[model samples]
Target: MVDDTGQKQTPNTLEEPLDLNRLSLDEQIYVNMRNDREFQGRLHACDQHLNTILGDVEETVTTIEIDEETYGEMHTSTKWNTSMLFGQEDGFVLVAPSLRVG
Candidate 1:
């Protein structure tokens, strides 16, 4: 669509109902997995099964521990980046392109 000045505006993809394959096409997306792991990447390709090829991927793995003496919690997070990645559909918690992470 174009504005009054005749400049084209980016389509709001969110206006459409989202399904996995549609949302995965050429967008920045987040994939939450089992075991407290999350992946953020630009989705290049995907299928109905949710198996995907992602580029410029960042992976964050969170770990929590308790101290025996204080009974306090210790939380740790490790993050890494990769140029490209492939993911299986197994153990996927959610895949969202709209949600932003801190």
Candidate 2:
């Protein structure tokens, strides 16, 4: 198919959306989860259901609260790292170019 840049783009033979994860094997990826939780890690393994096993993982959790006095919203983010992590299919996974590393 022709892209906006007038360049030809070849479509992948992915049967389903999750099939995109196969291309990210052994690569760094990002996962955005519920409750303001996020993950960044190397894609060690993944399944058809989008469940994944990651290595060298970093997890971030953002908590939002309101100040009792000012009634203003306060945001706090906490991060930690682990040697390995297993993530359920409860969120969205990202591959290269979209993966955020910091």
Candidate 3:
């Protein structure tokens, strides 16, 4: 869903997880800010909640060992303004002034 600022909020789903491993460094940080509980019931509500769920973040990097031969990493820096929400589409849809994460 798109907000007043034209920012999009993508809903999360059980079948699909927010794969932090696929995200880049900047994206990870953005996820962190999005998933902050304190920011919930606010503009970044969905973002914060999802980070709490799927983003195994520490300091700046969220690591994933895909397999014995393959691994993935997500690193983040400063947070950015609410622009888009990336995740699965199942349970929720963006309803302005009342956002749901999962």
Worst 10 residues of 1 by lDDT: 12-21
Per-residue lDDT tens digits for candidate 2, residues 1-102, read 776688775664354667668767888888888668888898989998778898999999999999999999999999999999988886664433245347
lDDT-better candidate, 1 vs 2:
1
What candidate 2 gets wrong by more than 4 Å, as runs, is: 1-15, 91-102
Per-residue lDDT of model 1, residues 1-102, tens digit only: 876688775654333344545755777988999989999999998876777888999999999999999999999999999999999989688888755458
TM-score of each: 0.73, 0.74, 0.15
Q: Cα lDDT for residue 14, model 2?
A: 51
Off by over 4 Å in 1: 1-20, 99-102
- For candidate 2, the 10 contiguous residues with the lowest summed lDDT are 92-101
Candidate 3's error at 85, in angstroms?
1.2
Alpha carbon deviation, residue 63, candidate 1 (Å): 0.7
**Cα-lDDT of candidate 3:** 0.32
Q: Clashes in each model (backbone N, CA, C under 3 Å)?
A: 0, 0, 6
What are the Cα lDDT values of the candidates? 0.82, 0.79, 0.32
